[model samples]
Target chain A: MEIYLLILLIFMIIGSIIAIEAKSLLSSVISVGVVGFSLSIAFLMLGAPDIAITQVVVEVLILVILIRATITMDNTAIEGGGGTFPFVVSLVFFGLFLVFSFFAVQEIPKFGEPLMRVSERYLRTSAEETGATNVVTGILLDFRGYDTVGEATVLFTAIVGAFGILRRRGRKKKTEEDAEKVGILEDEDIKKDFEGF
Target chain B: MPDIDEEIRDTSKGMTSIVKTVVRFALGIIVIFGAYIVLYGHLTPGGGFAGGVILACGYIVLTLAFGRQIALRKMNNKAASILDTSGVLAFLAIGLLGYTGGYFFLNFLGRGKMFDLVSAGTIPLCNIAIGLKVTASLFAIFLALSIFGRFISSLVDEDE
Candidate 1:
């Protein structure tokens, strides 16, 4: 199972890179879906059923959005090879990242003993204190509620930024269009044919 | 688009309108699942973020398979904005409730029972609130992006 899963991970990573680099928007979207599915499976194997389920659900959603967005996209810009300098820089950066990861992994302690001690310490009483069964929930909501609040705030900021840009554009468009005697909409035939978004 | 459009048109021809309609229905069902996942996230693996994305996915799928016009008619941009705003308000209200009870954002609400899906106190409520916010916000973002892209593309074509 481990070997098979490793192979799947390789395939998934390679596929995702290709998807990200692919010129055809449709194919790229499909590849992203494939990557999402594979990652969900990997999550399950890692004994994180909740994470896996969430990942799968979110992945499907993102793919759908990407597909819809792609419908309206130009899809003309295909990534071309960078000049030699940039290529060399990227190679060096990637090599450094690999070495850092290797060192980090080697320095990490074994997961079993530490996790067991922590669970033994607070697994039962944790839910009682936080009023949640899932110890994870207890930690996230009760112990780290501050962090959660910050996270939610981050999400709020992102929404506000996006909303501001879109709302401003909308106001500009409406005002401009209102000044005109005759409003010209996109051709009905073209509108009907448009897909995805 | 000359080549790809032909390919897409040919591929889509093999797919029937019935298939698209069925897909739309499925999307509605998916949205329900999203609601369930988020509302009961305290007990389950899924939470607001995952569920919100799922809900957004449902709308996106319908929009893609059918058209933007159909999506606008069904969910509508205005209604989405309302949902988005209400979600934020609900979240703030819950957080403020914490102050009156004791600490801010307190889950003083008792956990009703264990292993029961609804047992987790304010956690579930927070999940639901976040879920709503996330769904609306993400949907709004994508809708704007899609509309803007189309508008710009049209402008470029007009210039040419």
Candidate 2:
């Protein structure tokens, strides 16, 4: 199991590298999808089915949205500039991240070992207290209800903002066109003639 | 003859008939499955968010297979906005209902037998509400982004 997880992690790293280095936006999106799929599998192997399910669905949705966005953009422009400075900086950051994560991984409890008090209490009492068999749901919707509300609010705000920006841009374009036509009309006798008609 | 052929081709803006037919056939099952996941969230590994995503995928499939215009006609931007707001409102109302029991988001309703469908009281209700909110919000986001992309592309075309 540990070996399988290690292999999966390696594959995820490969996927991420491909995603970053790919020339085309579509290929990068696909590589990122691969990474997301591997992460979902890791979640499943780690006994978090709910997280795995959410991850898979969210990954698909993100891929679809990204593909749609990229399809409409200039394909050649998706190929980013090759800059050695940015590359070197990213490499240094990657090395630091790797070293930090290696030490952090060492601190985590071994596989199958229960971690501390909170989870134990949640497992024992959540069913009875919340009347929900799924302790995760109970914790999310009951014990941590405030957090869920905050999350929902955030999602709502993001969608509203996106919708507002898109709608506003469209209206702005139309208004600008109308203003231009009005300006053109202002300089002519035809403006008064058209108004009278 | 060329004009007639062009008009015929314009009738279906999506993929081939096989893809559209398959998606049309499968959409109902996908929606039903999402509903099942949401309704049985208390007893299953999936919940509102997961089920909501699945439901949104069903709409996405519809959009992909039948084009944006048809899908938008089915659930337009205005309706989606209304649904999105209502979902959050429903969830807030459910939380507020707990005020009668002395706490916010308290499960005031009776807890039925364990593992039963209706046993998880406000939990299933909350899941359903969240499912609605998530589905509408995701679809709305997708629609907005895609429409924006199309508009931008059209502007680019005009400029060119």
Candidate 3:
């Protein structure tokens, strides 16, 4: 298991490198997706199957949306600061950050150990109180229900913003310049364009 | 197969006939699987977010397979917006309902036998609401982003 985790982490590092260094948008986006998928596997290896499941699906959808976005635009010219003084300085900072993070990890308890002491109460009472066998779900929906409400609010705001930015033409009774606009594409035109896609 | 293929072509509005044929079966199965994950979240590793994402992925796959027009026929962006709004409202409404008992999001209902489908007092309902909200929100975001990207690209092309 340790070996697998090590391998997955190594792959993730490679994927991150490719994601940053790739010349083409397609490869960069795909590599980042690889990184995401690898992290999900690592989560599963760490005995967090719920996080792994969410990560996998979210990663897939993000990949889809990213690929579409990149395909329609020009995104080939991404450059890291080439071998310059600032680049070297940034690299040193990154190394120092990593070392500090590793040191912080050493200060923490073992992987399976919990320091909060709150989760025990959750595990003991959640099933009886919330009637939910899954402790995570029970805690999220029952004990931390207020937090879920906040999350729902955030999601609602996001949807509202998206709709505001991309309202449909069909929603209106009439438009003075409907057919001439490129934003509102004809059904057949857009459909035929991706006939084989 | 040929008959369906021709019928699909008549629309001239999607991916290759092969993709259309396969998606007919796969899409429904994926959606159903997502719903299962949401409903059984309290008993399994999956819960609202994962299941909702999977549900949205079903619609995303449908759109990918059949193109925007065909996909929109099933559920347009506005409909998705409505569903997205309703989902969060349902969750809040449930939370408010909990107030009648004591606090916000109180587990007022009878805590039935554990491990049963109808066991979770308000957790299952919350899961369902969150699932609905997430599914619709994701799909709506995807549609808006994709269409907006295309529109921007078209504008750039015209400028060039």
Candidate 4:
């Protein structure tokens, strides 16, 4: 288990280094995606299949969005290789990160010995009270339902915010022409799409 | 660099037919799998967010495979926004209904036999609500981002 974790962590670090060094946005995005995928694997190995699955899906969506953004934008600004000062600063940061993580690892509870002061009650009563065999779901939707409410609200606000940004901003004259040229979805669909807002 | 017109033409139609065919073969299965994850959330490891993301990605795959027009026509952001709002509303309504039991989000309904599909009372309902909300939110976000991308590209072209 420790070996697998070490390997995955090393893999993730390598991916991040590549991402940091990459010249183009696309390659950087892909390398970051590698780090994400490896993290999901680490989650699976750590016995949190639920988190692993979420991580995987979220990573996929993020990758698709990043790649789409990269492709659709003008990427004329290539990154310049760093000089000695910036490189030294980054090296210092990396060393600090490594030191911090090493100490953080020492702070973590050993595997299989979780601090169950609160979860013990939750685990025992959750199935009977919430009737969910999956304790995570039970806890998420029942015992800590307020969190779920907040989560839903956050999602709602985020989507609404995104729409607000994407809403028509005085481009009425060009919308139709661009829609036709790009075979875009009809503007009428987009215009009334904000009725929920 | 290639002519903008030619490049747009090539991409706007989406990928090769072979890719479309493969996606078509896989799309139904993906939707079913997502549904299964959502419905069986109580009995399984997954719940609303994961399943919802999968469902959204299913549509996203179609959009990528078939271009934006057909997919958007099938379920536009208007419908997505509606579903998104309704999902939150349904969840709130369920929580309010818990008032009958004298607590917010109380599990008032019957907790039937364990492992049964209909067992977990409001949990299943909550999962479904969350699923709807997440699926619509994510898909709508994708649509918005992609459209925004196109808009920016067009703006750049205009500047040129």
lDDT tens per residue, model 4, A1-197: 88989999999999998998788878888999999999999999998888998999999988987777787667634767769998899899999999999999889888779888889999889988888898899999889888899999999999999998876574465544565677666667756654555
- TM-scores of the candidates are 0.76, 0.84, 0.83, 0.82
For candidate 4, the per-residue lDDT at A126 reads 92
lDDT of 1 by residue, A37-83 (tens): 99999888877777897788778767766665566576545667569
Give the clashing residue pairs of candidate 1, or none: none
Displacement of residue A30 (Cα, Å) in model 1 is: 3.1
Instruction: Tell me each candidate's RMSD, in Å, in order.
Output: 9.3, 5.5, 8.2, 9.3
Q: What is the TM-score (0 to 1) of candidate 3? A: 0.83
DockQ of each: 0.32, 0.55, 0.53, 0.51
Cα lDDT of model 3 by residue, B1-160, tens digit: 2454454565555568789889988988999999999999999999998999999999989877776655666778779888888898899999999889878889888889988999888889999999998998898888787664454354223323
Of models 2 and 4, which has the larger DockQ? 2
- Which one wins on DockQ? 2
**Which residue runs does candidate 4 get wrong by more than 4 Å?**
A83-112, A170-197, B1-12, B151-160
Interface RMSD of 2: 1.9
The lDDT per prediction is 0.72, 0.83, 0.83, 0.86
Which run of 10 residues does model 4 chain A get worst, by summed lDDT? Answer: A170-179
Cα lDDT tens digits, model 2, A16-47, are 98897788877888999999999999999999
Query: Tens digit of lDDT per residue, candidate 2, span B1-160?
Result: 2353353245447668788778868999999999988888888889999999999999988877766656776788789889899999999999989999998998889988999998867999999999999999999987787665463353223323
Instruction: Give a tens-digit lDDT track for model 3, residues A13-59.
Output: 99999898888888999999999999999998888888999999999
